[model samples]
Target: MVSSSSDPLATRHSTVSRENVREEDALKVLSAYLADDMRACNQAIIDRMQSSVPLIPQLGAHLVAAGGKRLRPLLTLASARLCGYQPSAEQQRHVGLAACVEFIHTATLLHDDVVDESTLRRGMASANALFGNKSSVLVGDFLFARSFQLMTADGSLKVMAILSEASATIAEGEVLQMSTQNDLSTPIERYLEVIHGKTAALFAAACRVGAVVAEQSEKEELALEAYGTNLGMAFQLVDDALDYAADQQVLGKTIGDDLREGKITLPVLAAYDAGTEEERVFWKRVIEDNEQTDADLPRALDIIARTDAIKTTLKRAERYAHKAAEALEVFPDSELKALLVKTVLYTVNRVN
Candidate 1:
C-alpha cells in the first residue's frame, strides 16, 4: 500500500511499494548487494587478464575503481532475483557473466575516450589522458578479448549470441555517431537510432540475458527486454539533459563539452527544430563550422532556453521511465522487483 506522502507515479503506477521512502530503502538494499557482486566481478576480470604489463592492469583498475553506478550488473542480478529465481551458490556463474558485461562496457569507455579525446571521466583524468591514446586503445582491446573468453566459459550459446550481437551493434553505433558528428542537418530520428545502438542495445541485452540466466518464460523475457530498452533510452536522455543543465564542476566535464565535441544531442535537436531561420543559420556556422569563434555558446544556450527543449526532453524521458516500470507488472511483488522499478525512476530523474 502507498503512503499518503508518496508520489502517484511511484505508487499508483508500480506493482511494488507506493512509498518513496520505502523505494529509497529498497534502492539502498539493492545498491549494497550490487556493490558486493560488482567487487567480485572486478576481481574475476583482473585475475583472468593476468597481464605481464603492470600498467595494463593498473589502468584498467583505475577506470573500474572510479565506479559509476554499476547499473548494468545491478539490472542483471536484480532481474534474476525478482523473477522468482532464488539465487544459489551457482550465482557466481551469473556474477561472472555480469562481470563480462561490465568489462565490455569499460572497454568501450576506454576506446570512447581515445576516440573523443576526452580528458576527464567520473571526476578523474580519463585513461587516454593519463596513459596516452595508444595504451588506452590496446588495454581496451585486451579487456574486450578477455570479456569474450569469460563469456565462452558460461557454455550458454544464447548468452554468447546476445553479447556478441550487442558488441557488433555498439561498434556500428559508434561509427554512426562518428558519421553524424558536426552535421547540423542530422535528423532526430537518426540520433535516436544511433543512441539505441550505442547505449540501449547493451542495456536491453543485459536485462534479457538475466531472464535467460534465470530461465524465465518467454513472455517475461520480452517484457524485461522492453523494460531495459526504455530504461536505457531514458537514462541516455537524462545524461544528455545534464550535459546542458549541469554545471561543469558537478558534471566533471566542461559545460559545453558535447558542443565542443560537435555532438548534437536532444536539447540541440529540439532547439534547432524550434529555432527561426536566422537561429538555424547561426547554429550551422557555430555548431557545424570549425572556424567559428566561441561567441556562439551564449546564443546556443539562449535558444535552448527559449525553446524549452530541456523540459520537453525531460517529459519524454519520464514517459519512458513509466514504460519501464509498467513492464515489471508481469512479475510478482518482491524486493528485487521493487529495486528494478526504482532503478528506472532514479535513472530518469537523477541530476547526475
Candidate 2:
C-alpha cells in the first residue's frame, strides 16, 4: 500500500517543503553568488585538461562541452563560502582544487561508459561511443593524471590525501558494482556501500576539502562532509529511480537502461521484495539470466507500479534529502547555507 503522506511519488501533485525550491533557481543563485570563483575554476579546468597529445585535448573537450550540472565542483566552491572563506590566494586554491574535483569526476564518467558499454551520455554520444573504448580509456587516464597535477600544485598534503583517497575509493566502488551487477540477490546494505564509494565519497571529499582550505574547525568540516554525503545519497537514489520512471528526453539516457544492463537498483529491489513467486521468477529470468524481450520493460514497469516500489524508493530518497538539510544546522544561517539547503530539495525534485 502506498502511503501518500510518506511517499513522495504518491504525493507528486502536492506542494511539500522539498518541492518548494526549483533546481534552476537554486543554481542561478549559487552561480551568481560564486561568479568570480566559478570563472576562475572554469579557466583552471581548461588549462589543466590541455595536453600535448591532440587526442587527449580533443576527447576531453568533447565530454566537457557535453555539459552537466557541475554539481561536485559547485559543492566544493559553495562549501568554502559557507565556511567563511575569503577572497585571497586561499580562494584561488579553492578554484584550482574545484577544477581538480571536476577532472576526477569527468575521468570517472569516461571510464564508466567503457565499463557499462554505454553509447550515450548527457544526451549525446558517449566518449567511448564517439572515440572508441581505447581512446576513451586512454583519455580518461589523461584526465586522472591532470587531476593529480592540479592537486599537487595546491601543495597541501591534506588536500592531496583527501582527493587521492577519493580517487581510489571511486575505483573500488566501480569494481564492487561490477561484482554486484546481474545478481539480484545483492543486499541493500551492499548497494548503499557501492554508492557511498562511487558517488558519496567524492561529494564528502569535495565539501571536506573546501573546509580544509578555509582552515575551518573540525566540527565545520565534518558538518559539511555530512551535508555532501547525504545529498549525494539522495542524488543517486533519484537517478536510480529515474532509470525506471523518467522520460528518455528528460533523463538524457534510455529509459530502462538499468534493466537492459542487468543491474538491480532500489526500485527493482523494492518490487522484488514485494513480488509473488511468479514475479520473482520473472525477475530471475530477466535480471539473472539476461533473457529480456522488448516487452519486458513494460511488464517490469507494471510490476513496479503494482507494488509501492517507486514510492518506497522515492521515500528513502526524501529521507536522505532531509538528513542533508539537517546537517546544515551546524552552520550559522546565511545565503549560502539557505541555497545549499535548497539545492538538496532541487536534486530530489529532478523527477517531478
Per-candidate local distance difference test: 0.77, 0.85
* lDDT tens digits by residue: candidate 2, 1-352: 1112322232243222735334535655677678888888888888887878888878878877997878899999999888888857544888988999999999999999998998778889898988999998888888899899988998899999989999999999888988989888999998888888889899999999999989998998899889988998888988888888887875577788899998868988999999999999999999999999999999999999899788888788888888999999998898789889878876777665
Candidate 1 lDDT, 1-352, residue by residue in tens: 2223343223223322244443423345576756666667667766865788898878977876787767777777666666655557765666777778887888899999999988888778998998899998999999899889988887789989999998999999999999988887899888888888888888888888888888888998888888988898888887887777766765475666777787978888898889999998887877788446677667777888899878777777888888888998988887667677777766665542
Task: Give candidate 2 regions above 4 Å deviation.
Answer: 1-19, 89-91
True lDDT of residue 196, candidate 2: 84
For candidate 2, the per-residue lDDT at 113 reads 92
**All candidates' TM-scores?**
0.89, 0.94
Using TM-score as the measure, which candidate wins?
2
Q: What is the lDDT of candidate 2?
A: 0.85
Relative to the unseen true structure, what is the C-alpha lDDT of residue 325 in candidate 1, on a scale of 0 to 100? 88
Candidate 2: give the clashing pairs.
none
